[model samples]
Target: MSETAVPLPAPVFDPARVRSAVEERLTTFLDAKAQLAAAQGFPAEVTDVLQDLILGDGKRIRPVLCVAGWRAAGGCGDEGPVLRVAASLEMFHAFALVHDDVMDRSATRRGRPSAHEAIAARHVGRPDAARLGMDAAVLLGDLALAWSDELFHAARLGPDQLAAATAVLDGMRTELMYGQYLDLLATGRPSADVDAALRIARFKSAKYTVERPLQLGAVLAGADVGVRTALSAFGLPLGEAFQLRDDLLGAFGDPSETGKPAAEDLREGKHTALLARALRRATGTERDLLTGYSQGVPPGPAEVVRIRAVLEGTGARAEVEVMIEERRRQALRVLEEAGLPPAAGAILRAAASTLIGPAR
Candidate 1:
């Protein structure tokens, strides 16, 4: 199925408007942190990096989802507490990204030096550039992780709501770590089952990216069993589609648009659904090339092009696109069935559009 075949609603909240609100909230949160750091005698550069990571240019999708989920659960559209929760999610995300970049040995993120690399670059005279960078980045990630709980605790949630949100946060962190390990493990093996690979992708990337954020918001709003169940039903499939979209971007998205190198996932030997499907469909020389191409050092541009050709020739790219569309449709169906408040559901529907909707 073509991506255009999916019917997406007009987004309920303006993307620009939502983004502005998120930015304002993030600024407030970061400014307060900067003051706290200043009082503690933190170096200016350290505080700057922290603020940059927090207030950097991101889609702000997680926090938006949290707010949307809360609204869907009949919570008021108050920005104060929601912003704190959002900051917590964002902090946690920074923690994940810093560590993920370290594990992948990635040099750039969002079109700039990654946190660890940035820190390392500042210490040119240091005896251990890589080690120092890694260590500094790890420490920064830990700070973000710790701040996540502090923000969560500071939110004006009741005890029960706070407990529930904490549980979701804990599960998300643990599951994501496990998922990352599974991804690393898959690279060593010659072949992977497509279904199993999809499961891992869902757990590792999708839940953390989409499901947990929505669940966190819903729980904060004290959503009932039916409401929470509906949100999960809507979130899981949509989350999977979100990851699938990312997988496509990793392989084929423009480096300029995605703010990362094209085929970076392949370079990291990520065993995504697209790669797994391609491997399944490849034969003879194509299979040999793929097996050899993914191992050892990263493939150069010529090799990456060759790998793309194999994927295209085998129709794996098209097949994965079809799967992406299917998952999107399933998510929409769940939302339609959930019978959420029209306004809230509309916002969620819009959020889904923004998430998986095709690029211009």
Candidate 2:
């Protein structure tokens, strides 16, 4: 199977092109939903807020990966179904982000006010506007989740394709929820448990972000077990590397570039692998500072500076960079061994390189 002859895809098989296609589908789907809501006399804000968030700045990574997976599996011809599925994944991601913002009490996302914050601003006159916004945001997230399912079902796959897609989607959703729960439980009380942190990363970001999206596309193409396995080999490690990079970004990234506050992870006491590693190595003043901050000591400017110093001084940041490089190498090796056709291999390889590059 590794040596099976495969035809090359068109040169137009570009990430930017695929992203445009996926966004178009999302816009059309959401526009129809908005019309339906209007016809039913539902509040326009529901669809309006959702539209703004959905159409906002995003990398469109999942959908692009899905398309790449299909190509890798040697599936070709009409891309309509796969494009719809990709849009569905993006919609599901919206749901996740919406709820996550409420959970973290985040003020912004993608450089703009978060869903709850946006909703709260709408009812500034109300005394309980903040609480009402949060509750309403939760419902909005549920609506997005439901709409994701609607998009998936409307993709119109065959029986076998539907069954395969269902297996992957079901596992992805369940694992993501479990990972999120674990993360919530560990919040504000970080431990020096690198393994636990990695476990959460695996389920929450790695598998959900990369592996399952690839599998969803592969299965939709009727990919064999070997093909599925190969994609996992490449996707899982790449996904981990991506999350590791994200952890670094969350802790030390520039807000201008990342669109999130620098050291936000430390401020929120997120049990990231970077923090876990730092905790394992820190002691005396550094250890005391991290512990205090992790245990509800609000990180003032001084504390943020001290925490950054500890993370850097302890070599935790450097070690995470090492981890990212290692995982990227592993993923590239798998891509080579998988012997995917040239176009698909190029797409996946480029994705890895772009997503898991050396931190500046």
Candidate 3:
């Protein structure tokens, strides 16, 4: 008689487990990078700073979504390759955040000094310490980007998978740069153009943050067009909601929780959806106050108070909350219809909740 054959249990989707796995891979990979840098006589600061940023506090949303996408697309084998690619996305994010901080002149990230700020402190005695910090941080950001590519290549994906992943990544990077450029031009000149604000959110956050990462993992599993479409249907709205939440946090969140200064968005004159709504709906002194602040002037504490009052009085804050809830619903609806495995769908729902639910 032939021996009885038994099937292994299907893999369950656990967001915490996925996050842990991705974090482990990132730590290990960056440790190796640190070692290589030392061996090559590279500045210890480069590796040390990167290690802090990469292994520090983050939700690891992109990587978790990547794994969730793979699971959703019927991937049922080793997670080794998937985790590597996911880690690459985190590295790329580190690059993005570092550059973003430099551009915004932000002093804090993850509740601590940003890369440039930290670098400056290290060379405090130098006459050109500030410039040196900025330049070195830029190089560090570049290195992170390059190392991200290295991570992706080192994943050793097959030719077909590599091609697919490459296409998505290239598009994501291009979209991000274009979005940032657009944002740069619009900053300090914010208008009531809700559509334009949403456009920025789409490219800067929706596609780059949520959609592409999901697509990358889906393609890795040989997902079909339907799965790709489903991921987009779910990803776009959720990503927008995520950014909107960020805008709110930037404006009003407790600095202790958000790891950044409150009203920094107002100070930077970011053309966010919230600002657009305030610009549209505010009247009289509220309108003038918002208009004045939107002209690129950094708001002092009193000015920030007035701006917050306008944001609240104009109903922009409440409107944004509603928008977030609606987007969350839309994403959940798509997840329901996607016909993904039960576990995968649950994980996606959890991710959506994490993105749009509340501040952490």
Q: Please, what are the lDDT tens digits per residue for candidate 1 over residues 1-360?
A: 656677655345555665677677667767887888789988666667767766777888888888778777876646577668877888788888988888888888988888888888888888898798888888888888888888877787878987888888888889898988887788646464788778788888788888888888888888988988888888888888888888888788888888788688776667788878888878878877666745546677898789889889888889888988887788778878888878877878887888988532
lDDT of each: 0.80, 0.88, 0.87
> lDDT of model 1 at residue 228?
84
- Tens digits of lDDT, candidate 2, 1-360: 478789664654578988999999999998998999999999888888888898988899899889888877877889999999999999999999999999888888888888999998999999999998899999999999999999999899999999899999999999999999999998988888998999989998999999999889998888999889999999999999999999988777778888887677776778899999998889877877876755434677777778889999999999999988888889889978887777778877777876776434
Error at 104, model 2, angstroms? 1.4
TM-score of each: 0.90, 0.94, 0.94
Q: Which stretches of candidate 3 lie over 4 Å from their true place?
A: 1-8, 291-302, 358-360
Model 1 stretches with alpha carbons more than 4 Å out: 1-12, 293-296, 358-360
Per-candidate count of clashing residue pairs (backbone under 3 Å): 0, 0, 0
Model 1, residue 348: distance off in Å is 1.9
Q: What is the lDDT of candidate 3?
A: 0.87
Q: Which ten residues in a row have the lowest lDDT in candidate 1?
A: 7-16
Candidate 2 has what TM-score? 0.94
Between candidates 1 and 2, the lDDT winner: 2
